[model samples]
Target: MLSDQIKTKCTLPHSLYRAQQIKDFEGEAAALAGITLYSLMERAGQACYDVFNTHFPDARQVLILSGKGNNGGDGYIFAALAKNAGLSVQLCQMGVPDDLSGDALLACSAWQAKQGVVEGIEQADFEKADIIVDALLGTGLSGALRPEYQRLIYKITASGKPVLSVDLPSGLNADTGAVSDVAVKADATITFVGLKQGLFTGRAIDHCGQIYFSGLGITKQFDSLCSSSVTRISYQDLSDRLTPRSRTSHKGFFGKTLILGGNLGMPGAVRLAGEAALRTGSGLVKVLTRQENQLAVIAGRPELMVADFDLNKIDDSAIRDWATNLVIGPGLGKDNWAKMLLDFVLASDLPTVVDADGLNLLVDKPAWKDTWILTPHPGEAAHLLGCSISKVEDNRFSAVRNLQHSFGGVVILKGAGTLICDGKQTYLANVGNPGMASGGMGDVLSGIIGGLLAQDLNLQQAATLAVCIHGQAADLAAQQDERGLLASDLFPYIRKLVNP
Candidate 1:
């Protein structure tokens, strides 16, 4: 078994926290460390300025959109530094600068003292600016945008200016990844203190572009003091866990994977899953699809052992006996044929990756087992939870944890930030792209988990590693262009990551 070889614990580089959690962490830590708000504000601005200079060093003119609160405070600090550095800075105060207090007022005064006049929007020249800094709102944003902020945000967006947002893109919910009526679409975002939970998932990904982190000299303290809601998974963390196979290793050392799905008209689904299973290093892969689909599936990927389930000539006992692990789903529709095949697989004691229609069927039966991994997209999760898709999406972290509890196994909630939860721990995958939105993607994911399971990876290891592998492959494949990416395009990359 490869259980000893696989790493179940994730040492996340940056754990994700909610807006309030981060605030509390910063406040308590700053108090203990004797770090003043004024100095921290300076550090935030300094760190952001460094990253900005490295990225847009050639630019001479900058636009800083300042709002209320400490977010606006950071912008003022940045503008002061920029002006001092000989960059022409255009600072627009969305709110009156006189209203700013404490560190914010101090920052504004420093900028003014530097002869950097904070301009009104009417006086600001958008076309003259080389880069725009979004500081209209921060992690405190919720609900719809205020009318005045909306107009200003739209103006910046329409300018097609490369924007570097402060902390977060304004109007984005730092806790839920939900976007209000409007949010800043920045070219890059420099988040300070802690990595907000929202930045990695949902609509936040669309707004917070090319995310950069600046702990502002408080990263270690923040980590030690706060409990992160989710742990991010990366290939770098998992690479050393698997060493190169022994030269004398035999095929029998790896286990057999059985893939059952692809109802009559959907052979391609099963074929894609089966081929992916083979590519991911499963010792053997057999597809038990519909009778008519078997020949085409075999023709396309002959490495797979295709046994037509509907064909009475194939013995059920033999098919079940051949599998060391089972993958049930893909195009396994809700028809009688699919139900029959799924029931058989469900009855077996084999470890399984259940996805697509399998998850749909699971909604009705509502069973649980520690050995099964349930991969459900938002829609399927909604069905299982007996709620709206919006409800499932409104809180994906909660939904996945609930699924793990209800399913009594590993639950892989598939979406933007794919979440995997064994009863004991929850993991988030950061490797996928939007291009993975197309059809047959989940089928491939099911195959990967099942393939890893067949290799004797423990339930959590198999689910977590397979999720990362599936996402990493999709990301790699989408490099050419995510728009036209296909599920099969991930095959080569999937093979590469599994081996690495």
Candidate 2:
């Protein structure tokens, strides 16, 4: 119920930031709405206290690691509240309390007036504490940790205290989720006011364990104030976009989908895609593969029709006539046969999703066209966009936006936070888990999107729905256990979700 309520009321980080940006830009508009930045900060601190107490009810001794920023102010406020609530609290200041400015200084002054002791860098054993509140750094932190803060962070990590980070963890870059040097590892992180983008992607997710969000009394109207370039995919969202068909609907009502890949040794790629399309509600599914693997394409899934995609015999018109929506990639090799198949698909005007080897071939040839969805992992997306994989990793939002604008089609920049872009609009998918790091996952996703497209969903809708459902299935599969989970394991769950 908690997670469900979060999904329903709390939005993805990017959307939350967009809303806050708009509210901030309005200047006095927030005041008009009975909202103030200081009030937001107080609410943030209070929410952090609530989450900490809820997670560690038995923890009596609390240590608050505070910086000289508004985040520190939050910690100061929280420490005061904890003390008032009859919990023993300690403030280990990373810097001089006199160095604090703005609301943070005011908060410290308030706490000091209340007889709170502010101590300097001392090796007070945090292991003896019940919980540690990390308010040492805020989203404004960039680059490496300063020397004093570095020592404090290292000590906190080594202390083995159960940590509850206020907003983002100290030393972790909120925009990139990249750690400059070392970062505080928290058991739970409560983000407030606006959700930072970094907490959900890259290394941030691992560092920020058991994440929670509190809007801090910000109105929903603030959402319209800013525009976010990211979105998240959740299990609860799958059925809303992918409802079952009407009782009177027939196979003819859905469109035809074609899977164009599966080289000599990779018949499973096309097979997985074909089966996924069928399961995802595609009316008619066809596999256009090499003649050598014609029988292999329909191995277990005999319902799908197999076509021998021989270049010498097949023409563009013939391929066009079969697939209303095409998914090229999966096991597609970067050979001449694969090239011819890709050329045929690109020339046609049908909606298409290109992934895996299909992306590799397109990078080599470098053609620009629309009506396609390129689902590339970081490496593939990097190659296509002509940048280093690290650069893409550092800034996924920018990389995905570039891919969409340059390629002139919807782009599914697949990774932890899978980005979906269709020129003007961008959506971020926060579904799935680290368990989905296994092989053949991209193949399954490609097929799901192709199938959704065949069912007459528009390109944008199909991409979002398919990505959400695919990640959601993997998330569910991992519930049994994540370590040994396989890509094929998601099939039954996918069928249940789309058809149920």
Candidate 3:
């Protein structure tokens, strides 16, 4: 059974580190806290047991998989504790017990002294266990998993039983969040010391069901040893940026946003973007689209000013002059008309947001502009970088940085864990859910960023805050159900998020 805490969202720390960083400095941190390595291992084991007891107390049978490293040692200590608590515990060993050394050997001996039984992988009973504990590997693991380990991981996943992983799930890359081949699909993971950057992004979201963090009483000391590789931001961290508007302020005080898109057959994308812009507190929003899309763009949202864009009219000076910030390429098709409009938008000095077809169009004519923000999903990002989608998703941190370095602006790599990089620093927004797979979601995000940009927020601030707001809105809208969620469903929640 899943715990109530598992269903509820967990608050995460802002700073995130790579596995190597934590491993390199953990000993120093322990010394600073006046604790030995074995003591730290004991704390890690105790923390894992506490989480298991709190989250899965109803379970009477516990199966623990232990390896030969420190992670396995944590499991041994947990097994001893569970046995002492009068719970039925089965400790399965993946490697020879004599191979263990250091704190791990000590832990194994302690468990044996407690009259614990260790079984081989072949003797383990998956059906009899209420919950499985994964302690097969630690942060030091990289590259492909051993064939035996892979077999065990596959078997564990197939068991359909709840799993509690100590540190990160086995076979998961702690630095990049990339799985080489197979990884344990843990129901809940208790990460120790510092939070691993890999646990928040990429394939980690699918493999790690729920994440729980334990500093193990050395968080401050550990954090003081090294700087974080990335920073995590959410709605609560950025909501203060949207302060209450001055009572005397007029419509023009918030600035105007000009959105360009909505090709002949697709008007919904542009409409969603325009409405999202307005809902996000843009003082005014104007849409310049095809003549056929004019009515569709303004049908229900009469507040939006829609105009017919004359493709024959080469001069767009007047339209360009109207917007304080620009959002281009929601439903834009990659025809000559799109190219012309894109070129026109690029020629201007306006701070702009480029998304959807705009990103697709950029593949042909790549130009670096510091004033624009480029938002791209994996496919579009792979196109922009001339690489496979797998390559981009494999190491999203590297891809986002490369995109920002090449594009010379803020780059938002949209996915399960959205990454925003501005060349200087990178931020990860751990909000949003599977429901965001619906169409027009990207358009909504682009418009939200444009709206905030028009309201005088800098490029980084606008991108970060808009992303969190957009994701938080989606989460709220998906509260009742994530399936069948539409982009338009986020409007009311978006309004509330921005006001916060």
Candidate 4:
């Protein structure tokens, strides 16, 4: 399993940086540590070698595909180390040996000094190798791959061998995580220097299977040189926020959460959200839906208080006075009734969590409020941003930032690597799995955030903690099988995680 191959000894840093930041400040960081850039490269290569030995201990034959850059230099250094260690190692240099310069040329010379032969791509024996090391292109790639690189990448991918990528897989945008044409999909990736922000989101998640980080002994210096572009978080990091509740607390101490949605024929959406809120520790949970849905919404869940919502009557002030927190738009169809309820919820200063049709409604009305949190998947985010879904996925960090700027409050852009932005800082939650793609997941997430907000957590804290809890619940529920997992499977795990 992919999880079994992960390196648990190395702790990952919470701060993430752009590629340019690493390039610009890496030299100064090294200098501050009294080390040269080439020394950093050597440490990077050694880190990769250590990961390979630890993970692929049984493998004897290795193939290293190297380009004419620092990334390739790291590969050359690793090749020399492997050859000296009595492994059958073949180094395939992508570009001409004469084209190499600076530290790359020196690395190539070191490999040759160790009697390691540099072969061309044509001579690489993919079938004979137990593993392939991808050191081509690295994080410098911006546009589509060159024809030669593309052909090599296709050949390597088709080789059906376990692959380890150095720094990052080739053809992946270090800033956006988007692959223009093609990218190397590695079984494991060992990154150096600062952790690249792009490796955790969008298409990069599929390409970068298991990630290992190495700061090369200069991380503290490097991190001090510049501010990080993003923050990476997970359930383990945020679970402490769910501290022990007051021993003498009553039902009203936790605060009440009022959920508005479940239009005609859509009772299931509101039911799931209300239950998730209850599981997340909301003191009092209420669902205000169409009169016809009141029974269905509260059928199996007796804890939720169900009430009939009539658009014609529209007692907005009375409803606002009842709950401490509001959740709008689960199974809320884009109808006049849904619109009126959304407007009613938006009119108040109550902390609100908006998802599904509430986000779609905002695309037209465009209300910006500091007291609400907007959670949108890629499709809904596209609509809110007035762009294509592809555009939003192309650069999720940018999309989430734009969403926060335009809509105000905190914004959660949900996907493989869910991102939360609070206008000032951006956070990436690396907790969820593919099984979470099923229906009603967003509704559950919205409810979780609303429950946290109701419990007196601020917008950023509530959004970040809720996202971690929601995704971690899905991860636990999918441990047996991810293929047929349901959104409701997370309820038990959610209750357990919140207590931690």
Instruction: Compare candidates 1 and 2 on TM-score and give the better one.
Output: 2
Clashing pairs in 1: none
lDDT of 2 by residue, 122-157 (tens): 745587788889998867576667887787788888
lDDT measured at residue 436 in model 1 versus the true structure, 0 to 100? 87
Error of 2 at 311 (Å): 1.7
lDDT against true structure, model 2: 0.80
TM-score for each predicted model, relative to the true structure: 0.91, 0.93, 0.97, 0.97
Model 3 stretches with alpha carbons more than 4 Å out: 1-9
Clashing residue pairs, backbone N/CA/C < 3 A, model 2:
22-225, 231-428, 232-430, 233-430
Tens digit of lDDT per residue, candidate 1, span 207-247? 88777777766666777899875878876766555568889
Q: What is the C-alpha lDDT of each candidate?
A: 0.83, 0.80, 0.90, 0.90
Best candidate per TM-score, number?
4
**432 Cα displacement, candidate 1 (Å):** 2.9
Superposing all C-alpha atoms, what RMSD in Å does each candidate have to the true structure? 5.2, 2.7, 2.2, 2.2
Write candidate 3's Cα lDDT for 1-500 as tens digits: 32322212456678888888988999999999999999989888888888897778788899999988999999999998899989999999997789789999999999888777888877789999999999989685878999999999999999999999999999999988899989999988988888888998999998887788777778889888889758999889899999898889998999999999898898899899999999999999999889898888889688999987787774767887788999999989999889988998889889999999999999999999999999999999999999999999999999999999998889999998899999988899998999999999999999899899989999999999999999999999999799999999999999999887
Candidate 3: C-alpha RMSD after superposition = 2.2
| Cα-lDDT of candidate 4 | 0.90
- Candidate 4 C-alpha lDDT tens digits along 263-354: 89999999999999999999999999989998887786988999887676787567778899999999999999888998887778999999
Decide which is better by lDDT, 2 or 3. 3
